[model samples]
Target chain A: MTQPIRVLLAKVGLDGHDRGVKVVARTLRDAGMDVIYSGLHRTPEEVVTAAIQEDVDVLGVSLLSGVQLTVFPKIFQLLASKGADDMIVVAGGVMPDEDVVEIKRMGVREVLLQDTPPDEIVQTLTRLVAERGER
Target chain B: MSRYVPSSELVERAARGEVPAIGRLISRAEAGMPEARGALATIYRRAGRAHVIGLTGVPGSGKSTLVAALTARLRTQGLKVGIVAVDPSSPYSGGAILGDRIRMSDLVNDPGVYIRSMATRGAMGGLARATLDAVDILDLGGFDTIIIETVGVGQDEVEIAKASHTTVVVSAPGLGDEIQAIKAGMLEIADIHVVSKCDRSDANRTLVDIKQMLTLGAATSAKPEWQTPVVGVSSYTGEGFDALTRAIDRHRDVAFGTASGSRRQLAIARFRLEKTAENLLIERFAKAAVTRAPALAERLRRRDADPYSLANELLAASFERGSAHERDHHRPPHFAEDHW
Candidate 1:
């Protein structure tokens, strides 16, 4: 039998605001996926390490502290350096449209803004996981 | 035919202490994939070598931090550790956001430690059966110590006390009196009562309260063979770890040193057997009962028949059918097909 999708939800950088990530955690959980949430103030290295160690199918980083440009790429580089580039990485929390586009260009599977509904986040994650699993 | 059969390659890799292979095996177990049973069957022979320690307490009780600290300490002593953190699943989605991994990030890069998060997945016990299976896999994979940190819901959490050889129930300061740790019935199951975040001013009072409760409780009414130690620990500062480890070692020596230790082992074995049998029996019979006696449920719902007698009647019918099938070589297609 195929394993259920496992996603790691992390807050990267100085993002002490975690209310959004908590909601996403609950939403994904309600959607019947296994989610591992690494709490706030995590460096990119810490996030990548946890994602690989946990063997998660996807990594969703929430960054409300406005460092997505630097954090997301560093995370991608770390995932590459650790030979975990195959892990699907997504971004959420507060990011401007232009920065979201730039971060997406940096190998984020998807960028979910703060306005994205919880259900939509779940749907996006489900789709991303399924798409990745097929590969 | 076997429901699921683990690949020999995967089993071999896990047995050789390959991290990814062990992670895959644990994932299969958590998902209740049929082949997981076969994998566990293979691993079970090599398990029972590691000490299983269970940690439980209320939310925000510093369980994850303590686990990290303990893993660090154990590693310093040249012991390999495995951690299984059980998280509560959402009632609506049957999914869980397991956050325990976040606290132990420092150990993620260490080859001496392995951490996996598990969702309850609607299991009757506080922990999903998969959690136990994962622990066994970790044990067989060469972890000297396995810690099963549980999500601390009230009554359901009692199962952890039974599942582990040593149950450490953690509490912190400022939970208030009416909702104190004692009121949660945690004291009954605690082999070691850990007061975490000892840096708080109220920490001393919480320790005092725990000591007072232990003294007053029935667990200490008589001159007990071993006294339960309430140790204060601050996971942040790493204070009191020596005392905590000593307490754990002392308890382990006395518990495993005596005849009662063996008795406790027997009890755990019995629990495992019963739980597995009960789950299998329910899977086989519950569906069969619904199909054969659809009206039985309706009648009971209408209060025409009481649950006690109805349960007895169902059990009798189920047993008779089961025995007849076994003895006479008769089979019910639907009965055998419908299993969770």
Candidate 2:
């Protein structure tokens, strides 16, 4: 049975550096996730709205700038209001570990610090998809 | 023997293993059908079973060979892969030649792989919603990983992530100002960066430039989960496919989680809806104006009224209908076609 994981990846802030995000987007696309990239300078609200509307299984936010707190929460609160408490939110960028923890508590499940391998990202998603695929 | 059929019928028949019908439906979409929306919706409910990966880079990035290599490796793992290879739309005929898929002939006929070639129909970026829709259908049809390979990420390749989960930006050894020419929109969307055709002389320099760019792009306080991993891969000699696939698996499996999944879906859904509405409204608005064109134009030519006023008069109700915002939000097909 073929199921394409729907993923919403967005750049949630003013930073427009997406070289990394573009690579990850293609990687996920090849792996078979229907990925939607919310274009540059997307507000947290726009990113979250796109995630909810796309019905994505993975919401991967790419931030080159250090504003995950403001951006991630806007997305989180937006998802919460839409009754999507179980969605997966992943953040990737030059994030420090402490900031990553704070985002996680606010509803993000995993925070990928820089240099994480692509296979690891795929593996995490595969396991989660399999787990959810069971549900 | 394949021919256009009602989208619903073709979609239903295609669902039952009728490959031809599926081809026809995809062909119609390739031909640019407004009704592909319904077919896409049917496909969406049954989607989410495939891993969607996107490949993009400038010309000669060897995206095709890279994809071929990756597909070969994925096949080794006993996985069924669907490849959506996009070629640039013919400027004259407004159709795609799909020359990229020609490189993956080894697996094209394999029952384990399904390869579909699409022409980039001015979707502004090699990635288009229709391409994504096709991916959605294939996903529902049960492919393990759906690969959308763009020949190169030219100015138009910006559209990739609108429909995929992971976006991979590919670069190779030989560009002069690729670093400088990179735009703000294109600079910020990568999840993984690959140096395709790395056997070239200056591949290392390109890699270094990519790293510098990634670093320059990052900002304060945003310690993202992972740094953009730049890997060197040569699609021609079967080098790095394993590591590439490994990178892909990690990005998907470890870097993603459950909190934002639902929200991402919403973003795509809304974008699709808005796009559909915008298209329909434009089509309808254009049609309405065309029907009344003769009378309005005659009046204007006679100096009886200004063209803008006439246009406003003719489109007054449509304007009052507030269809602009709604049109920006959603749409259904109208009776008239833009038939010449």
Candidate 3:
């Protein structure tokens, strides 16, 4: 039997705008993924720790506080240190196109802009996890 | 990803309290991987040590908060705790967002405490079967106590009764009808009834109502049972936790002192055995039924055969095969095909 894809959604940094992440979490859950929402006001360390402990297939960080430059890099580094770098990392929330490219360059797997539809986010996550192969 | 580890090695690592190994083993159990059976067989005897506690209540009754507080209190005694927070899966998607541990962020960093959130995944029981499996793994991993928390509603939440030695029913101020729901059936199964949010004015009323119901239940009951204690606690104000813990300890003492604790153990053993056999029989029957369902359906649609008789026949055939597999060496060839 195949396990359902497990995804962790966290609000990293001081950005309290969690409505978007919560909606995405609900959408992904409705798409047949076991989602673990880490809740709001989570630091990079806390998010990475939870992602590793939960052993999720994907770690999604939704940050609107313009701290992705610092938070995403630290998260990626921590994942590598914790031997979970193989897990897919996706970022969402308000972002400039250049920042999205930069974050992706910093090892963030996918960046869904604020304008992306919830269904699209779900589809993208499904496709990314599928591409990463199975357990 | 740790599936490559042999079952024996996984069990060995889990016995050492390796968190990653335990997580991997539980994932295998949840996925129903073939290796899980072998792993469980190796670890099952190492279980039965952990105190299994079941917490259930209506939504927003602060069951999660109470669980966190109780866990923290237990940890202060230098005991390792494991929590299985069972949440509901979406009926449409068969998926869930397990957010119960969000209230216990402080315990996240505690190595001695392990919290795992479980989605019911359409399990008929409020507590998922996988939750029990995980609890076994945690027990084998040497946790001193394990807590299984579920959002209790309607009749299904009674399933929690089988998962723990002591079942704590959490109710709080407000939700008068929900409290009534608890009184309808849960009051009977509860070892300890907790009225959380004790700081609220309605707390006293809720306490009085629960005590009244418990007293009423005791009066009408036929069997001798442990008297259920109702404890009022406010996790927010950190009040009544000491009393709550003392009540839990007293209940444990009474249960262990009498035959009720052993009865709970027997019930759990019977439940696990029956559940496994039930799963196996259902799988075999469904596979056999598929080949004959179309004709059965046609007969039913045409009113040539009533559903009750057809269902009985299906059940009879399944049971006959189930019994024959244990007793007889030579089996008939294609039993369903030959008969149908």
Candidate 4:
């Protein structure tokens, strides 16, 4: 039997706004993927540690606290240090277009904007994991 | 990601408490990959040194919060703790939202604590098929205490009793009538009972109700060696946790020290053996049925055969094919080869 795609949805930094992340979590679950939510205000280190421990197919970081530029890079560094850089990383929540480009440059495979529909979020995550050939 | 790593190397790293290695081994076990069988066998052999505790309760009973509090308490004693938290999978999507870690976020940064969240993935009895394997992995990783937290379960999910050395059942105030515990069959399996949300005034009713039920049970049953204690704890104020821990420690002593302890061990072994065999049989049957089921369904639709006879025919054919495949491979069944 094929294993379901496992995703870790983390709210890194001091982001107390979790409504968006919760919606995305439900969206992913409805689309047949296991979503592990690492509640609000997690540091980059804590998030990466959980993702590694979970051995999830994807690590999706949700930030509404405007720390994406600083947080995503540290997460990638931690993942690399732990020999888990092969795992796909994705970012969601509010961000400027230019910041999204920079975040993608930092090795985040996908940048899901606030306007990205629920269907697209699911499809994008599914396609990303499929491309990684991990599931 | 599929690149092969020698199980021996992974086992060595895991034995030394390497976090990433432990995580990888757990993933392999959860996926039921054949390559992980050898590593799991090694893990199982190294396990049993750690105390296994199972916590079960209905939804919203503060189980996850209690686990966090309990882990912190155990850590204060310098004990290394490992937690396996199970969450239910959605029946429609076969997906799950494993939010147990939300309550456990504080414990993540501590090196002495390791928490893994599991999706039940359609397994009944309030646990994932690989839950015990993950527990063994943690035990092999040199943890002092391993806690298995089941999904907020309802009646008849007493499988936790067979898997844990000590089973703690949590009941909260205002969920329903006080007799919900007896109705859920939790009274029989609980080694220690906990009334969470004790800060609430109505919590007294639940506590009183459970105490009354225990009294009734004790009167009817013969004198027992170990008495189950009811603990009222408020995860918010941290009240009653010390008492809870004391009860757990005392029970562990009884479980490992007394003659009844040996009997409990035998029961645990029997349960594991039966569960492993059942899982293997279902898996092999599914594989064998894939090719034959379509034709059988067609026959049934055409009224050429009755359902009972066709089912028997399918079972016989599947078993025959299973044995033939075993002979051709010149190996024992996968479950026996891997687990035993």
Best-fitting candidate, scored by lDDT: 4
lDDT of 2: 0.66
Q: Quick one: best TM-score, which candidate?
A: 4
Interface RMSD for model 3 amounts to 2.4
Please give me the DockQ of candidate 2 compared with the native complex.
0.01
* Residues B230-297, model 2: lDDT tens digits: 88888767667777888888766633453344454566567667765665566556655655667888
Q: In terms of DockQ, which candidate is stronger, 2 or 4?
A: 4
- List the candidate 4 regions with Cα displacement exceeding 4 Å: B1-4, B181-184, B220-223, B322-340
TM-score against truth, every candidate = 0.80, 0.60, 0.88, 0.93
Which parts of model 2 are misplaced by more than 4 Å? A1-135, B1-13, B16-18, B31-39, B183-185, B220-223, B254-256, B260-263, B289-340
For all candidates, state DockQ relative to the true structure. Answer: 0.38, 0.01, 0.47, 0.64
RMSD values for the candidates in order, in angstroms, are 5.4, 22.9, 4.6, 2.9
lDDT of 3 by residue, A14-44 (tens): 7989998888988888888899999888878
Between candidates 1 and 4, the TM-score winner = 4
Task: Residues B1-340, candidate 4: write the lDDT tens digits.
Answer: 3454566677888899988788888887888876678778888987889999999998888999999999999999889999999999999998889999999888999989999999998899988999999999999999999999999988889999999999999999887664564445899899999999999999999999889888888866532768989999999999999999999999999889888887888999899999987887776567658767889999999999999988887776556634543444322234353332
lDDT of 2 at B32: 47
lDDT tens string, model 1, B67-93? 999888888889899999888877776
DockQ of 4: 0.64
Interface RMSD for model 1 amounts to: 6.6
TM-score result, candidate 1: 0.80
- Candidate ranking under TM-score, highest first, comes to 4, 3, 1, 2
Give the Å shift of residue B127 in candidate 2. Answer: 3.4
